[model samples]
Target: MWLTGRSIALIAAAAVSLALAALVGIPALLYVTGLCAGLVAVAVVLAVLARPRLVLTRTVTPAIVEPDEPVEVVLDVGVVSGVPVVAGHWRDRLPSTVLGTATGTVPVTGEPRARVEYVVTGRRRGSHELGPFSVSVGDAFGLVQRSLVAGGRDRFIVLPRRHSLDVRVGPAGATDGATRLHPTSGLGQDDVIARPYLPGDALKRWHWKATAHHGEPMVRQEESELRPTVLVVLDADPRVHDHAGFEWSVSAAASVVAHYGGRGFDVDLATGAQQVSLESGHGLQDALVVLALAEPDSSPLIIPARERTTFVMTGSLDSTSAARLLQAVPSRDTIAFVARGTSEDAHGALAAAGWHVVVRDSNEDLEAAWAAATGVPA
Candidate 1:
């Protein structure tokens, strides 16, 4: 409960009226003072009654989206008891870091229900709460105001957007021991199970016997082929990078994983301590989300496995660490994305050590960096 500017002015007028009536002995001034006081009392009571009657409900379309995409938020406000509500103001509470403060006016105009809609962009990748809508109502006379917090919150996730890669890739590295144990069976082998041919099935792998028996082309469901693994190591040391640099490194790592995974190359994602190999029963989206929310890795980078191709994204790396990284993968198979601040000698040593090196300055685009490092157009 609070007094509006109009309420303050009215009270001041009443005080003046009383003063004039007492000093000049004017009886009409007393009547004027009484009227003003009565109106003020009525305004205050109306404001109190109007506040509790407001209802707010928040809804969002496409609650899950990629970062930097726009999202629509709708706020439905209605009055209980179908009563006429005066024009009011409203503001939706959101995290400043996520979305800036959003505020506007609520015009009832004799309607029992009203809707307020706004747009906000998901600027980062993560799960975030949208709002607890707040509304402020004042009396028609604007003599008193009441503020109420009314709506529940909504949760949404801004997933990391995957980048497209147009470059050609080489054969995958060796399969893990687990894959070796479950090698794909051949068509004529006893373990062979024939299934109806699906699109993209190789014609050469079709079983002629099964096709003749079933009158439809059937393909052997050979166990999935084991592809060479591409290990991706992301260095998230906070001491080495600012927030922007860390995000870039994350996006770079995610892009590499996605590029390799899409190309049928077994992809493995690793941070300072966490390692997720998609070939080993890990979900792709889950891996991307982990990368999206990855914090600076306090522990140093330790390669989890040997692979045909290794992509390393880091803020900074010393010569010793660079040398160790080169030895982690096959010769000329490591590609390094080094954020600015790494020494020239480190870059030179990594390159001389047969690692493809890309040195990126602040805010460098990932596609451009990749093109520069691999000598391929994005």
Candidate 2:
């Protein structure tokens, strides 16, 4: 539905020739106008008749990736029944949420099928739709051009990055009761079961009720252990941090989730917007996706992080935001990973709330910051 440069030049030439024929009384000028006009008309007719039916399929390799991770995209192109498409240019629409070069020269051989490819990296930690791919086609004389659009859309996702907070953490204070209990049989001497007593068994192991009911002495045998639970909370207030700082907080929370979950701690993740109970350290993907799609919220950080061990990951805080953060928690063991630019009031408030506050820059080494938070001074 647009004009090409060549068509514009031809139209101009035809108009000039007709004008010259009228003023200069030259029959040759009229012939030139007729030729130019006739050629333009034929080009238009060909453009209208020569329509193409196109099918495009696209794929993103390594369906799961983190921000700035390069992903290769392959577009399979096929032409069904239509006018013979001449060799032209093809370009895929890459949205603002992604970064890549999506244009290439498309050589239309006699074959009906072809392939185009490009690489795109997701700009942020979320899912974004890719395209409604289109290509340009034109007549043999290159006087008229038309566009062919492929149907449908494709979705791509970018996950939050996880850092190895290389610190051996001490007991994360957690509650005793749990819905999903992992059996710790033979690991410790707690939660013992009564069994038939044997000779040489200690008197302390004897169960009086079993002895009376079974007509034989029954002794206690120990079995089963319970895994501790930890709650990882992310602060989503936009006023507390700039863009980079907020992103860093997200990555830090992801690291904490992975670290404890792998070591057998039941983990739960929370943002001001949503909370996901990752009981028994299962549903790790569910936690990550939440972080990926999370946005800064105006809601106060007053969600209950009642677990014995609670982690608060957030950016630099002023006095006001620090007060807001203090509202949700004063858990038995509280840890806060905060930005380096934090005000003194913020630090004092967290300490008053009994949190072991750790401060560092968004770009600082994650391991170093974690070590400082959990280990003895180096």
Candidate 3:
């Protein structure tokens, strides 16, 4: 409990009155001092008892959003048991970058429960937590106040906004219409032919009508091709990129993933030590969430030597690191988006190694940078 200015002033006046009563032997002054003391005691007791038996729960609508979108946070405050407080204060804890503060009052009447709604805008892309809510209650006279923690925290992720690119970066690995031949593997819409059944084949693959026609156990033959795969490598080492540089890299990487993944290309997202190959449907959203929360790591880039087309987005790159990348991806068929502040030698090394390199300044437009990198008209 904390004393308000009024409470402090009353206590001081009481002490002065008591001192005067002792000096002048005035009974009225003693009564005035006693009255002030009694009021303070009552206020203290009320403040102590005014701790509201409150249950608080916080929920955020659309927990995952892109930057600049507003998220509504609703705090439900219900009184379990206690005298209805005349007034109470509440404040929500939020990230410093998120706009707006949650501050309001609990009214006297209406329902035993109240909902406080506040909209918070995400200023940047990343994961954020919205808090342990704070509640304060005081006596009717507002002389003493007591505060308590009411609610647990909730997590929200602000994903990077996907930018539109006029120039199409086609799926990697193979042409759009190309198909790969496979032994009648899994059942799918692609099965086109039936041949004599092979040993150890599952009964499910046996074509019953085709077997009777061929006078033998015939199995279905299906032809399916692996989808073109695109690898997105993000360099999140804080030593190279400051906050702005890192954000740009993240945005660029997200754009690349969204672009090809939308075209039915298999997307592989890698940052720091984490790597995941995305499936169809909700897979891209799941990958973006991980990318939004990715932080800097001290490890160097570890690009696999696979033949899939690779895209590297980094704040800075040294020659040694570039050489290591060349060693892993010897085809040098990689596309590199090197952000500002990287050494010229690093760019030179990657370029000399046959990689298509895009050098971007701090303020360059993403589409224009990409156009210049891929020799496409924006």
Tell me each candidate's TM-score.
0.70, 0.74, 0.77
Candidate number achieving the greatest lDDT relative to the actual structure: 2
Point out where model 1 deviates above 4 Å. Answer: 45-55, 78-87, 94-101, 109-113, 124-129, 150-155, 159-163, 170-225, 263-266, 274-283, 299-308, 320-333, 340-355, 372-378
Q: Where in model 3 is the C-alpha error above 4 Å? A: 9-30, 49-54, 79-87, 170-223, 300-305, 328-332, 340-345
What is candidate 3's lDDT per residue for 69-187, written digit by digit as tens?
Answer: 88999888876535445448888887786887778886565787788888898887887888878877677787777777765789788998778764334223222121211222345
User: Candidate 2's residue-wise lDDT over 261-285, tens digit each?
Assistant: 7644667787885888776568887
Judging by lDDT, tell me the better candidate of 2 and 3. 2
C-alpha lDDT (0 to 100) for residue 125 of candidate 2: 80
What TM-score does candidate 1 reach? Answer: 0.70
Q: Could you give me the TM-score of model 3 versus the true structure? A: 0.77
lDDT of 1 by residue, 209-267 (tens): 98789775565654453224567888776766778788888888888787766544456
Q: Which ten residues in a row have the lowest lDDT in candidate 2?
A: 171-180
Off by over 4 Å in 2: 3-36, 49-54, 78-82, 111-113, 149-153, 170-223, 301-305, 318-320, 341-346, 376-378
